[model samples]
Target: MRSVKTLLVPYYEHPTERPDAWDALLAAADRLYGVVLNPASGPGAAPDPAFAVVAGRLRAAGVRVLGYADTDYGRRPHAAVVRELLCHRDWYGTDGAFLDQVSAEPEALPHYRRLAVAARTAGARTLVLNHGVHPDPAYAELADLLVTFEGPWDAYGSLAVPLWTAAHPRERFCHLVYAAPPDAHVAAAVQCVVPGAGVHPWGTLPHALEPIR
Candidate 1:
């Protein structure tokens, strides 16, 4: 049941900037596990009115609206991170949190565990950690979904999934690939494959969910 959403979209563009892309995302809401809303890459200095509207729409469509939280690979202060998560919740009424730049080492587990606890205490119903690689198998327990793979299309085929992944349900993992081939196939439980590449890959809508004209 946790694996119901097959796509975890991190479309970073503002709704006003890309109205069509946001419209397309709304049209494909049924297939989304969640959409990561990055208002100035961590809620900005204050709340964004546009993001709030989009979040409301996504929630109405039965899609989890996740607020983006950058961990700075655990270097950022914990309180700062929590503040961002809270801002996402209070400002946009997001039901989930997308913790990005997460550290994948076993030693960093305690730090993340604490952060995860803070997130839950603050009312994040769904938590996703974007480790961007197959982290220590134990990293799977700190959040609801682990982004085990994140890269370009050319590097995806050569990826080697860790055997430890077999111990957990596939739903526990997600893959994010940009500049992906038109016929790309991702065997993971959840994914976000986009054709847009360069400095920012997530700004474009996934081709699979082409805007409903």
Candidate 2:
């Protein structure tokens, strides 16, 4: 059977505020493979036990779970993202992580490699470098999943998915974009090219333009 693709929900809040989000997410999960939560999205937030509760619920219901951190954005301390993720394992209760904003430059790869190692050491699988384009060949092997496309709806089809899928197998790739008016259109284009398209509609456009916290 073909492996199912999952939608990574940008973790919008702690456990107390997530009922609506969880309901909507589970509804989506009913159709798709699973959901990934990004606890690193909320500002001034410390790890919450409630996250663990929800994570347990999702896993019990048979969702393939994952978590995230936007390591490449702004002045957000990269180490802090790592620390928070490690501490809140109970909150995410997933098999692995999607480390966003990794370096594509060849020289910088090793640094990211270390971060991947760190994440792995903390009992999390490390999938790094979500470059929304066809990344360097060296990057393909570094992470469990290379997020090849992450951008606005308009840019989805014009960039990496086509070129990357043509060269790589459908199983080795994934893509994420904010949900927008043309989301289905974008998903159709991506799935046509690569069956491994993982589309994440962040409910609204991600505050990607502003510095991700």
Q: lDDT tens digits, residues 78-113, model 2? A: 577677557545445666666666656677666676
Give TM-scores for every candidate, taking all chains together and pairing residue i with residue i: 0.96, 0.70
CA lDDT scores, all candidates in order: 0.90, 0.55
lDDT of 1 by residue, 36-83 (tens): 999898989988899999999999999998889999888999999999
In candidate 1, how many Å is residue 104 off? 0.8
Tell me how far the alpha carbon of residue 102 in candidate 1 is from the true structure, in angstroms, after superposition: 0.6
Candidate 2 residue spans exceeding 4 A from truth: 1-3, 11-15, 28-34, 40-45, 73-81, 126-128, 160-167, 187-201, 204-213
For every candidate structure, what is the RMSD over all alpha carbons to the true structure, in angstroms?
A: 1.9, 7.0
lDDT of 2: 0.55
Candidate 1 at 8: error in angstroms? 0.7
True-structure RMSD for candidate 1: 1.9
